[model samples]
Target chain A: MEKIKEVVINNSEDVILARQAAREMARETGFGLADQTRITTAVSELSRNIYLYAGTGRVIIRALSKNLKKGMEIVAEDRGPGIPDVEMALQNGYSTNRSLGQGLPGTKRLMDEFEIKSEVGVGTTVTIRKWL
Target chain B: MDKVPILKMGDTLILAIQVELHDKMAIRLQEDILKEIHDTGARGLVIDVSALEVVDSFMGRVLSDTASMAGIMGVETALVGIRPEIAITLQEMGLELKGVHFALNLEKGMELLQNIGEIFYGED
Candidate 1:
């Protein structure tokens, strides 16, 4: 795996930046137009969650390869008030902010693989990948 | 402050979003469009997102909200130029954007708006 870009999500503008970076990286990683849109949308949801909950965070995009298979990876990390109930947060329509509660689960559906780790008062990290 | 320009074309307001819309920009656009509708008494609005390659849930909500707001003000809103990929992703994410009208392109969107205006206010 090779890290291609790192975007600091401190505000709304950073979220757009992160989306653009992820889109570009996904393009370079040989994803089709639909896949590129999927990757970018996932990045937007995760980055917005960071700005909303953590106030600040970072998104890391990477290119991964194993044998002949290639994939793109996105890692979002935040050091804010972490989620107390990870399972509940992943469920549909479980928003804490009156939203549609589609951020985490939607991102999970867009990517091929999803993993989340969180601790109350510690932080949270979500990693996702899509293989080509 | 990034602002998406809203142009008035007769009884219609045209907003062409050519850049990636952030949360603040989306909210600002919503406010600006609503104010324009109030100030000009526009009967129709056309939002062209043809240049936007991706749209997330927040942007989707903004579009939906803007459409509903315009509807409440007696204005018909048409969303135009959503790429196929964006449509697929929005569907997969469960952001159906219900109660909103869509057009294949800007010309069709303008035509749809004109038809909606006629249906709402009767033909002049």
Candidate 2:
């Protein structure tokens, strides 16, 4: 994997920046408009989750290749209060806040591969990828 | 943060969102639209998102909430110009965006609002 960029998600505006950066990278990677939209939407959800839940986080975009498959990877990491129940967090409509609670599950649906790691009071990290 | 420009035409208001809207800007737009409707007594709203590349869950929620709010204020609303890709993505993300009308483009959106108006008030 090769790093493309890292967008910090501190304020609400950073969520937009993170998604825009993902869109540009996806476009440059030759993904069609549908795929690009998917990538950007997934990034938007993840980055917003970071902003809403963690208050601050980092989204790192990376280019990955193995054999003939090439893909884009996004890693959202936050050092805020970690989710104690990761399973519950991944479920739809389970938001503690007033949000719609579609962030994690919807992001998983948009990407080809998804992974999440977190520890209570330790923080959380979510990684997702879409292949070309 | 550029505000989405709202144009008043007769009894209707049209909002064209040209810039990639941030969260704050989107909320600001909702407030602005409500204010405009209140000040002008507009009966219809058409939101054109043709230039937008993506409408994520947050944006979708804002649009839905704005539509509901406008409905409470007696303004019929229509969302127009959702790109094909965005339409599909919004569906896959489980954002039904119910209660708000939809059309292919701005002209059609206006027509929808007109039809809705005729439904509420007898067509003359």
Candidate 3:
């Protein structure tokens, strides 16, 4: 695995940057247009989560290769009020504040592999992967 | 600092989104659309997204909400030029994009808008 880029999410503008970075990396990692779009859109949702819930966080995109398959990975970490229940938070139609509950599960569906870890007061980290 | 341009063509408003719209800008565009409708008495709206490469959940919600809000204000909205890939993504995300009409292109969008607007503005 090699690190591609890291975008610090401070506001809405950073969200756009993160998406663009993800798209570029996805294309370079050998994803087609639709998969590139999926990767970029997933990054968009997760980056916005950082801005909306955590206020500040970072998204690191990485390139991965295992055996003969090439893939891309995204890691989003935030030091905000974390989720008390990961299962419920990942469930569709579960949300807080202004969200319509599409952030977590929606991103999960867009990516091939999804993992999330959150502690009530500690923070939250979400990792997603897509292979080509 | 970026604003989405909304063009008024008689009884309808046509706006094509060509820039990378951040979250704040999306919200701003929604408000601007409504304000334009209020000021011009436009009964129909056509939003072209042919230039947008991606439509995430946030942008999906923004579009849905914009259509809902415009529906309440008696302005029928027709969203046009949604790329096939974007439609696939939105469906995968479970965004139904309710309360708005979908058209293939700007011409189709305008026709759909006028068709719906007949109920709202035909008396005039």
Candidate 4:
């Protein structure tokens, strides 16, 4: 895996920047238009989550290759209050902030691989990948 | 500060969103459109998103909310020019943007709003 760029998710503008960065990286990785949209949407959701829940965070975009399959990876890390229940958080319609409640699950569905780690009072990190 | 321009045309209002909409900008648009509807007494709203390359969940929600708010104010809202890729991505994300009218282009959107006006105002 090779790092592409890092975007800070401190405000709404950062969320858009993160999405743009992800879309550009995905395009460079040879993703189709639809796939690029999917990746960008996923990044937007995660970055918004970081801004809403964590108050501040960073999104790391990376290019990955394994077995000749190229993909784009995104990692969202935040030091805000971590989710207490990862399972519930991953479930659809489980947002504590009264949003559409589709951020985590929807993002998971958009990407090829999804992983999340969180500890209450510590922080949360969400990683996702989409292959070309 | 970037803002979406809302233009008034007769009894209709047209909003062309040409910039990347951040969260604040989206919220501001909703507020501004509603205010315009009230000030102009416009019964129709046409929102052109043709230039927007990406429509994420946040933006989708804002659009939906804006439509609902317009509906509450007796304004018929028609969203136009959603690219094919955005439609597919929105569908896959499970955001159908229900309750909002759609059109292929600005002309069609205006025609739809005219029809809506006839339906509500019994035609001129």
DockQ scores of all models, one per candidate: 0.74, 0.73, 0.78, 0.68
Q: On a 0 to 1 DockQ scale, where is model 3?
A: 0.78
Q: What ranges in model 3 sit over 4 Å off?
A: A1-3, B119-124
Q: Looking at candidate 4, what is the lDDT of residue A130?
A: 87
Interface RMSD, prediction 1 = 1.2
True contacts kept of each: 0.77, 0.68, 0.68, 0.60
lDDT of 2 by residue, A11-96 (tens): 98888889889989998888999999999999988888888888998999988887999889999999989898989988888788
lDDT string for model 3 (B30-118, tens) is 99999999999988899999999999878888898999999999888899999988988888888778888999999988877777667
- Can you write out model 4's per-residue Cα lDDT over A22-128, one digit (the tens) per residue? 88888888999899988999999999999999899999999999898999889999999999999998787778883577778888888889999999999999999
The single-chain TM-score for chain B of candidate 4 is 0.97
- Stretches of model 4 off by over 4 angstroms after superposition: A1-3
What are the chain B TM-scores of all models?
A: 0.95, 0.96, 0.93, 0.97
Every model's TM-score: 0.95, 0.96, 0.96, 0.96
Superposition TM-score, candidate 3 onto the true structure: 0.96
TM-score of 2: 0.96
DockQ of 4: 0.68
The lDDT values for all models are 0.90, 0.89, 0.90, 0.89
The weakest ten consecutive residues by lDDT in model 4 chain B span B90-99
Maximum-DockQ candidate: 3
